[model samples]
Target: MSKTDFSASQLIEIAKALAASGQNFIWVVKNGEKTEGEDREEWLPEGFEKKMQGNGLIIRGWAPQMLILDHEAVGGFMTHCGWNSALEGITAGVPMVTWPLSAEQFYNEKLITDVLKIGVAVGAQEWSRGERKILVKMEEIEHAITELMVGEEAEGLRNRTRALKEMARRATEVEGSSYCDLNSLLGDLRAMNLPATRTG
Candidate 1:
């Protein structure tokens, strides 16, 4: 994953874009402490609060645990390619627009974008060498979000994710592979429960 930073202005821009797109029920999670050295009002763009008041854009400080992502209303995720987030999204059959933020995150992006085909990489910065900053402009962010929200690629990923989720469910059913493995382990345990051989 590559290191990246964003100003409050940028976040506000994103919120505005989401609003302009007529997105309903948009949720954003961020750090609680407001960044210093900027005007408080400017931290959030003018009219943003109004747009969110009844239009469905929700902005909250602090990261969401499991609720928002799991909600059916969540059609897309703008993520910092964490492995756990990737797995959760896949399991929930939610497609994502990945924004890697570290070395391992770059690798995870490969798994998501290249291997699993469940996500799209958005304005990825090279992870090689000492280069630390990979900036993604608001336009790219808007484009990626739009693409992932509604497009052929997004539909394909959604279908694939759903299939994968179903397959995972089947793997844990009573007659499934994991179930059989568990049964086999139980049998071994039962054998161990038998009386020990006297000659042993």
Candidate 2:
């Protein structure tokens, strides 16, 4: 449910994918205001939402995404590859289908897909910075979402995501990597007489 922007072609593709997948989804159109016009039907394929009404909940405006991702029913996410959203999905132990919008999100997608092995790339792995944009076909999106949701091929992705979630949780505990690193830094500062080590 990470339709980050209003790409008409991409949206249509996503609509088709959602319709074809037959999985339960909560799609959030982030910038629905862009379609405030008479040609709204043209904006989204006619009868698309109606056909999908049974299994999909298409929200036109804001949504509580963090809470939704945290839910047990949400097994995967359609992500824009934004770092914050990526981290949030990981924290929620949900795997992602990466659809990077622009900028460094492409890199983040790679980290998740290649390095972390916790996600699958939907489309547009190239960088888009107002100069060029890649249109991801509906079939690719459909395949990506299907694989993520219930394709049985996504078990590895889910397992890796859960492992990462545990690692992230452990990193915050008193004896974890993050906690130890913070203490080490503080100890060094204390040795240097830095006031940052003292209680305020």
lDDT per residue for candidate 2 within 80-127, as digits (tens), equals: 889999999998899999988677898999998899987878877556
The C-alpha RMSD of each candidate to the native structure, in angstroms, is 6.4, 3.9
TM-score of model 1 (CA atoms): 0.73
Backbone clashes in candidate 2 total 0
Question: What TM-score does candidate 2 reach?
Answer: 0.82
Candidate 1: tens digits of C-alpha lDDT, residues 97-135 = 898766588888888778988887777685644433444
* Clash-forming residue pairs, model 1: 1-102, 1-103, 1-104, 1-106, 2-102
Worst 10 residues of 1 by lDDT: 1-10
Cα error, candidate 2, residue 16 (Å)? 1.0
